[model samples]
Target: MIIRELITHRWGNKELVTSPSFGTVEKVFVKDDMRVLEWEPLFIIRTENGSLEQIAVGVNGVINSVHVKEGDHVIPGMVMAFIKDDLLDSDIS
Candidate 1:
C-alpha cells in the first residue's frame, strides 16, 4: 500500500518509503503547516546515480515534521517528514 493509505489507516503496517539507494535531499517543495493534496510533490532527492526522484505526499494532509533539509544525505527508511491526516473536520478554521 501507498504511504497515504497506510497513514490514513493508522499505519496498519507501520512501513515507510525508503530510498532504493543513498541520496541527498535536493529540494523541499512542501513545508510544515501546508495543506497538501494527495500525491503532491513534497521534495526531490538526487541519487548517487545522478537521477532525480520526486517524493510526493502520500495523503491529503498537513505537514507535521520535516526531518531532512536540503543538502542532507539520507538513507533508506529515513523519515523525511510526517503527514498528519486530516481525518475529521474541525470548526477552528
Candidate 2:
C-alpha cells in the first residue's frame, strides 16, 4: 500500500521574522524556490552601528517565497518567506 504521512512544521510553511532591534534588512542569501537546511542563515540584519545579525531557517525545507530583500525594512513579527519541508511523517507533533 502507498503511504504518505504528512508532517507539518510548527510555523507551518511560512517563515516569519521579527527584528530583535531596529535594523535595516542588509543581505538576503536565499530566494524563492531555494532549498535550505536547518539552522541555515537566510539573511542578515544591520543596525545603524554596523553590527549585523543573521536570520536562520529553523527547519529543513524549500523556500516557497521571499517577501523581503536587501535594503528592505524589517519589522517585528513579520513574515519573511514560506518554506515547504521535503519529508513528512505521522510522527510530527
lDDT, candidates in the order shown: 0.65, 0.66
Candidate 1 residue-wise lDDT at 6: 23
Task: Give the range of the ten consecutive residues with the poorest summed lDDT in model 1.
Answer: 1-10
Off by over 4 Å in 1: 1-20, 88-93
lDDT of 1 by residue, 1-93 (tens): 122222333343222334434789888887778788877877788888878877764577777667788998988667777776655434565
Taking all chains together, the TM-score of candidate 2 against the true structure is: 0.70
lDDT of 2 by residue, 28-56 (tens): 88898988887777778786666777777
Clashing residue pairs for model 1: none
Off by more than 4 A, model 2 = 1-18, 87-93
